[model samples]
Target: MTDPAKAARRARHDAIRAQVADEETEAAEAEAAENAATLDVSLHLRISHTLDAELRRRAAAEHIPTSALVRKLLAQAVRQHDACGLTAADVEEIARRVTREELHRSA
Candidate 1:
C-alpha cells in the first residue's frame, strides 16, 4: 500500500531522468554533426569476432556505440599515417625487416 504522494514523486523523478537522457543524446548528435565532414560516407569492413567483441566492450566502457569507437580509431590512424607520410609499401617493408631480424635472432 503505497501513498499517492509518494507514487507521484517517483513518477516525476522517472520522467525527469528520461528527459535528461534524451537531452544528452540530442546534444551528442548535434556535436557529432558539427564535427563530421560530408555527413560521413559509409566504409564497411568485415571484422573478426575478436575485434568485434573488443570494439563492443570498449564502446560500452566509453558510453558510445561500437561504430563511433571504430570511427574515432580510424580517424586517428588516418591522421597519424598522413602526418608520418607512411604508405602501404613502407608498412610492408617494415614488417619484412622485422620478421627477418626476428628469424635471424632465433637461428
Candidate 2:
C-alpha cells in the first residue's frame, strides 16, 4: 500500500504534466494555422503508392508537407526556366503564334 500523501503528490505532478502538454499542443496548432493562412493555393492529387510513400518520407525529413515540398520544387523549376534568357515578350509572341495555328487548324 502507498502513503496517501505520496499518492496525492504524484497525482498533482501528473496533472501539471498534462496541462503543460496541452499548452504545447495548442501553441503548435496555432503556428500551423498561421502557416496555412499564408498559403495561396490548395490542391489535391492522387499518387501511386510508391511515389506517395517516398514523398511522405521526404516531407517528414524536411519538416514540411508533401504539397509544400512539391510547391517549392515547382517554383525552383520555373525560376530556372525563366533564367534561360527568354523575355516575357518572347513568351507572349510564342503564345500568340500557337493560338493562331490552333485557330487555323480548327477552321
Candidate 3:
C-alpha cells in the first residue's frame, strides 16, 4: 500500500520535471531552426594546388573546414566591398585604417 500524500507529491514533481524537459527541447529546436535559416548555400569555385593546400592548412589550424574558411573570408570581403562600394582607392584607405588600428592597439 502506498501513502496517498507521498504519491501526489511524487506525481507533481514528475510532471514539473517533464514540463521543464519539454520546454528545453522546444527551445533548442527553435534555436537550431533560427541558426539554419541564416546559413547560405551556393556554388563555390575550386582553387589550384598551392591555394588549396594553404587554405586546407589554415582551416586545419582554425579547426574549421576549408570551405568554411573560404566562406568566412569571402563574406567579409563582400561586406567590405558592398559597404562603401569599394574601389582601388577605398581598398588602400581601408588597409591604412586597419594598419593604424593594429599598431595603435599594440602600442
What number of clashing residue pairs does each candidate have, in the order they appear? Answer: 0, 0, 0
lDDT of 3 by residue, 8-59 (tens): 9999999999997876676566555645876655776766999999998997
What would the TM-score be for candidate 3 when compared with the true structure? 0.42
**Alpha-carbon deviation at 27 in model 2, angstroms:** 12
Q: What is the C-alpha lDDT of each candidate?
A: 0.83, 0.80, 0.78
* Reference-based TM-score, model 1: 0.52
TM-score ranking, high to low:
1, 3, 2
Which portions of model 3 show Cα errors greater than 4 Å?
1-40, 86-107
Model 3 residue pairs with clashes: none
Better of 2 and 3 by lDDT: 2
- Candidate 1: residue 21 lDDT (0-100): 97
lDDT of 2 by residue, 28-63 (tens): 675577567777667778779998898889876766
- For model 2, the superposed segments whose C-alpha errors exceed 4 Å read 1-39, 86-107
